[model samples]
Target: MPYITGERKQGLLLPSSIEDYINPSDPVRAYDAFVDQVDITELGIQTEPNRVGAPEFDPRAMLKLLVYGYSYGVRSSRKLERATHHNLSFIWLTGGLQPDHKTIARFRRDNQAALSNILKACAHVCLKLGLVEGNTLFVDGTKVHANASMKNTWTEKRCLESLKDIDSRIARILSECEQADASEQGNPSLVKMRECLGKQGKLKEKIQGVLKDLQAGQKNATNTTDPESVRLRSNGRLGVGYNCQSVVDDKHGLIVHSDVVQASCDSNQFSLQIEKAQQALGKPCATACADAGYASTEDLKKSLDEGMDVIVPSARQVKDPSSRVKKEHFAYDAKDDCYRCPQGHLLRYIGDHKQTKSRIYAVGDPEQCRQCPLFRRCTNSDQGRRVERLFLEDVRERIEQRYLQADAQAVYRRRKLRVEHPFGHLKQNLGIRSFLLRGLAGVKAEAALAATAFNLVRITTILGPEAFVQRLAA
Candidate 1:
């Protein structure tokens, strides 16, 4: 019933190397080897041991710290800095060099592009190791809480209110200046007045800029703390956050690409992310799977036209409330370019719905529509039931059919498990539900490292620790 012998605080200790502490099977060993193999200096990270003012922490060591931290969910710079001082694996990774939090934070902030390039390099490594099969690739997105306070969130109405308040202040200031000028020519306090004007001008410009952004439909809600972060709903709760997208090969669920988008929706995210995956993997994906959120006519056109098999379920239309009749209950007539209601009424083509890029069909005879037994059930609208079919409706229909197939559903169902490998581990296991960095750029830097860390863990898991280390050396 005795614990392992403890060392005395003041006793002379035997000389020991930190490297002795890391096990051969430790994932950190593979991570160290991976960083050593990557040419980070060429990827835009400047490293020179001779720099003045402070000892430059080697870029390789810094990258290892970041990536290793992310692998276990230790993303805070301060925490990573502390890890250098006490964490055994970290001490071995850095060789006892402890860079302050500022240094750690600056490296990540300034080398985001380089860090992102490292993630691409990881994809290439996956391909090299045969982890990426170039077959079915699952693309998915999840929202992470941004490093912003809800108090800073501004709605369109809030922006307008701010603008109005600024304008009134400006008016009052200018009127006071005019009164002062009239009271005395060459006002003795003209310099102070000019300073006041300048300050007001800058204030007005900032408010106007926010107002302009709100008016331009940039985002529904913007946070002043991190202007690029948008208010989005994730896990059925509204919060200020960024959308993080990931592309994973179905074979090993290894991430091939990732990015932090400012937008809240995945509708327009597929094109850019998939293209990056192709560029990284050095080959086009044979097939791609995504959830219903990613199914947009514009994006589907691009993905399909690019020759990638896509299985994104189209957005479900609202079903008739009274009768519980779904839009699918209606039949489309290609020859007539109309829809036949389940109740046997002809809904003729009306016009193109520009917003949706779809053609509208409506029942011309409200009397006939009301006569149907499913009238109020089918549609409560007095104008009769209407349907909007996309000009590219055939593409959606094809995708819908493909998604319903036994084979396609089998592949599609794996999307959550496949893509969520990184996110679930990052969030639930690593306790990274909220980002520690603010602004889109900072969050992106964090994401690049976080993803690279994930790839490292996945790589080691697939190859085993010893082989992973040996492969990096190879």
Candidate 2:
């Protein structure tokens, strides 16, 4: 068949297609819609809600935008504002209008405490949903960035130097003012110089105040922050960062409890985190696991006191080879509070309160130490041979007792599978590298948000979309 010429076969002109897809369904809208169902504002965020003021923006709306934005990795406030105007999802979520960057930034900064409370509220909701199964809780600490800096910080000596610099600058400003006065005929520069001198005086006052505070804190503090924060190095580098501690449930990898601390090491982190986790669940933890870093005699005893079966490696001792061989080679006597020498001479206790307070116990008679052939091997002190037993010796004994237990090993093996898996998911999939906020308070809030985000993912994974929607609605 040959090709036919075109003919007007169309009857009445069909109506133009009416559906023009101007705005597609937005994920931010979907997320915000989910948040809108929650009654977080009803929980009373602002302490004084009735103060007469200009028409205030809804805290809930701001909260919804922030949580949704952070969940999707849109962290910058300025960027979020732009997205509200341009992105369909953000536009839908923000109700076709964009809040200014100052408003968004103020929401985050002014409401830090309120935002923190909201996190706790979210955890309570999770508990209400029966999402937390506290069969095992793994505790660990990670370093996060702080607001202070290595450069801004000053050590004891550096602080004095800073004060001197401020004083010298103030003196120079005063000298300039004096020189200006000598040549002044209502000189404009003289007025400026006086103002400059006034500002310099204020700067000197602030520097002096900081110096006084630093000295006071250094002299009084049982634990001190080097340069404004304690001198603790992480990842083989010295920087100011907080150690964020978390105790996560193993069953669902949900964080049961979390805290922020200024401590540089994990030595004292165990008991506090474990106890908090236990308290949150309202039950005693049957078993707990930690790395060698948290292993300490005091913590082991505290864990025992809490009725928690702890699994940790033994603490290392700092001694030269000779002392190591001498004491370790011989057997320790608990009842006698002494050690038996290899030659079978009983090492007796000699009272020395000063050494004892330092956790060193004086043992063996001075005469005995003076006479023994092995004196050269053991005794380097002018006093006598001493054996320093840890105050909580039984704690170490208990740790050794648990180290041999099969259940301890089983729990420890579960630790990597439990806590690290969630941490890996958060860092890799959720994009939590460093905190968006700074300082202890800000970092704590960020940690809470990260935990909440992780839990949201987990809740979605476990409950599926439909069930999670129902749970959130409920």
Candidate 3:
């Protein structure tokens, strides 16, 4: 049997076309058509006519290259530069123009705002295609590794210790220099010592600046490599990264809103993400579902007040393991504004605890509880059995009641499917586990591009290349 053979170097009589190299159904073609139809001005791409220096490449082409490159998991500027030269699809997308790595990197770095606008534009396109159901959004956050290294991160105490060590070393070196200078003149060791001193001085100045900023309450932890990156606990490991939050629509699992935050916890991000999603969609979200991490009393109350139906489990429901008596065991007497304990003891409401923002309700007589046989099983505190209810506990209770209903639970169950699928695809399929850009702004830009690419792929999947091209034409 003869093995199939192919020509390594064959001369062609007819001229080869970059267009013919790519198929009509190729997603790159769809992306090219999409970019051509969209207004570059809305994407914040610079399109001014250049009369002076060398004529600049069209921003539209550069954006198309980036969107297409990122869609295929080519994130590095060097790799993208290489792709333009070697990859036929990229050649077709860039129209035979190969911008250097520096140009590509600068475009990404300087146009973070533009990249975010592009993400919004992609979401708007999804909305127009009926791919996104703006009425319902599933909100969640994932910890994506930053471009910084955890080894470069320092706590306040570590910085202080480092500064102290630096000061001591400088003092010791200066004393040694003074002693050596008295012993010998114009020594090579003295010159090396002076150089070392200068280096240490500059380092001291940098550390001191960081310390000053930290003392002034500007930052929590400092990372010398990427100052904007925070040291967060992610997936049972400590790392320097950003908390990327996304609001995904339920209809087609399209991302409607996304943001990169420095906070490790997502408790305070619920209202902010919901508001942003509403603004992006130009309408209020009928319902928002999230995990227990976003179940803060303040945020839940604020979301409820804004007429957003928020479905989130309590922190205990998701995290707590102890099988202790639950708050539901206590019966509330609305008429008397008191709680009845399991032993039929009336727990009267004390003064509101302003610091904790809760109404303190405790058994009226501690003596009776102390004498009771069940005291050992119930009262762990010396002050007797007490229950603290949030001032807006009713709002949370109402949500919990609604969540108990079959329909609300069904909607809540869809949260994981709607929100986690995109994250899994980005991390596992596209290799977006860590960001290639440093700082929050750059990370946000990378995330925006990633989301745009994901949305583009999704849109192309829903509408084939020809149909998508027709949509773009329309």
Top TM-score model? 3
Q: Which ten residues in a row have the lowest lDDT in candidate 1?
A: 317-326
* Tens-digit lDDT track of model 1 for 274-308: 88888888888889888888888788779899888
Best-to-worst ranking by lDDT: 3, 1, 2
**Model 1 lDDT at residue 185:** 65
Select the stronger candidate by lDDT from 1 and 3. Answer: 3
- Pull out the clashing pairs in model 1: none
Off by over 4 Å in 2: 1-44, 47-54, 92-97, 165-200, 218-231, 282-284, 317-330, 341-359, 362-386, 421-439
Model 1, residue 171: C-alpha shift (Å) = 12
The models' CA-based lDDT, in order, is: 0.83, 0.66, 0.85
Q: Over the stretch 302-349, how does candidate 2's per-residue lDDT look in tens digits?
A: 887866777876654322334433545556777866767665666655
Per-residue CA lDDT of candidate 3, range 1-474, in tens? 999998968876643777787888887888998788777787787677856778877788889999998898998899999999999889989989999999999988888778877778777777777778798889999999988889888778878998899999999999989987999779999999989999999988988888887788767788888989888998799999999999999998888888999998898899999998888888788898998889887888888898887788887666655555556778988899898888788889887999878998998778878877777777776678888888888887887777778888899899888899889889999899999988887888888888888888888888888888887778
Best candidate (score: lDDT): 3
Residue 139, model 1, lDDT: 89
> Model 2 residue 10 lDDT?
57
Worst 10 residues of 2 by lDDT: 17-26
